[model samples]
Target: MTENPGFLLTVLAFVLVIGPLVFVHELGHYIAGRIFGVKAETFSIGFGGTIAGWHDKRGTHWKLGWLPLGGYVRFAGDMGAASQPTAEWLALPPEERAKTFQAKPLWQRSIIVAAGAIVNFLFAILILGSFAYLEGVPRTPPVIAMVAEGSAADRAGMKEGDRILSISGRSIGDFEDIYRIVRFSPIEPMQIAIDRGGNRLSVDVTPGVLVERDRFGNEYRMGQLGIGKPPAVYDDIGLLEAPLVGAERTWGIVRLMVDTLGQVVTGRRSVKELGGPLKIAQVSGEAAMMGWESLIGFIALVSINLGFINLLPVPMLDGGHLFFYAIEAIRRKPVPVEAQEWAYRGGFALLVSLMLLVTFNDLTSFGLWQKLGGLIG
Candidate 1:
């Protein structure tokens, strides 16, 4: 199993990673809808071509689709396809259109739609925070964990367990500080002061440029000082602290996502680097191979992506719907149905196009496209 080829590994990875994360996301919306009395017609685990399905007492159809990329919830009178009314719904007079989604208050409708993405972010934070608190964060204490063989750090005589006291006379705190210095440091000679063998020593090493990928697929060269991180000493806290830490971490990730988007919009980053489902599956399989902890970590990471994606100000998405609500709140009436239709059409096209591009990139990155090219060549 460990030696399995890439295609099988990628498929299994997609199932494990995308499947549960998406289910949890849709679950958020489904539960919120039920709580708020907005009848859901179907809760599906994928898009297009249902593989299996069952109906519930609440008149909701649960389904597993043949395609495993993504899922959706069909609400009663959802203003689009994917739903059908039961006899009871049809039996109701025109005057009693209460159970329809359109009948719900704008605020309630917004929350129900937004819950899926919100829950995804919350899930990420909670999971990461729990992991952090449980095992303690891996802290590279101004100290080297492991020096990579023949790397810059190893060549500079940086040994495992050697605590870096300073860099160019600036005192160091934790591993992050070292990373900051190393990642952004100019490719020039720099002095590093370390406490090795209980004695302080200073050595000069030149930072080297290494290529790395950002969350977006853009590659950039950055300064590198190769060193691994050691496990932090676990310091337990009250139950309340865990959630707080989780929330802060979640917010930070959200901020990072927002910043990345800004960079893309500002032309400081490449939009083509944006990854879609295929890339996620590849990452998931890679993470899974590392360990359960790594897989769970990837889940937390993707949860953040799910949350942010839903918040896009495009119609048919949670954020897009919210944007309409905002306009309604300002104008004191719903946006014209025609306007919404146009917006949704545009958004759907943009989303679909983006998906196609990312899928292509994913295949290309996995060498699938390259292999096909080779066969033809």
Candidate 2:
């Protein structure tokens, strides 16, 4: 039987993308732990059986697992990848206990737990900043060059040469800002503040909903104002300023993610849009085919997502650990072990359910069920 070259490329691309990101994330935790005088017992770049491994001079057992889905850093006295405290760890003598993660001050522990996501965000910023430095930043003005007839902007009495000042009270700096605001806001009403002929005017416009498909045939629902802009102008970014640009871009992505999740929660967007590992693998492969630049950009985007997701207040995640730490701070003591265990179990279940949902969406997006039906027919 011949192997599919495309499938092979997809698998390789997925591994290449995920492995480094995972390593960066865990390295964040490991570094933070080391800084606080805590020892990492094991640093594995995947879960389950070890494919390759070694011990550092510090005695941290570093290993590469067969499964490349995710990775973890197990600190001394930590029970598992989730970093649950162990009975043996708790029972350790004062000297030994001081070297464990749980023995750290609340603030230090919080920083240590939150370090992975922070590093992910920083990694994305570095990549994005490099791109900005090399390629320059878009300096497009927010002037409307064209408005489709009888469309949302036209209906709202907007005209060509009108410079958009703000959308929903958020100031717009460039033409790209308009698209960013409109894209996730399908059919949503927004207040548009524009300066026409040097006179400021405010108009309420409901964006027209558009269903667009990508080259991969994946569908996206977007809001369009039926407005167009002139060609974008690129300005060379200085070395120092490029990082600021990258930070701004990263924050913009974070805000967009928040808006997306809000839309999903409010029933404005479908949950089916959520994707999982398979979707990532497909996209990674596609990006690889597009070139190194595209693949690198995709990695940065995913890195931001990873950082954002890990910060959510869910158990078995970094955020969940921070949540417990927050409670510990308030109560002046840790949460009861039994309560913590139950909460962890619930969090684990919630995560598993979400994983299944996203996986199902991925399969559906790939037409897996349709192909199966065809085979049966």
Q: Which candidate achieves the best TM-score against the true structure?
A: 2
For all candidates in order, the CA lDDT equals 0.77, 0.90
Per-residue lDDT tens digits for candidate 2, residues 1-377, read 31222888899999989999999999999999999999899999988899999999989899999999999998887665455577788788999899998788889889998999999999999999999999988879999999999899999999999999999998899888899889989888899999999899999999998998766565678999999899999899899998899998899899989988998899878899999999999999888887899999999999999999999989899999889889989999888878888889999999999999999999998899999999999
- Candidate 2 has an lDDT of 0.90
RMSD of 2: 2.6
User: Over all chains combined, what TM-score does candidate 2 have?
Assistant: 0.95
After TM-score superposition, what is the CA distance of residue 111 in candidate 1 from its true location, in Å? 0.8
Best by lDDT: 2
Clashing pairs in 2: none
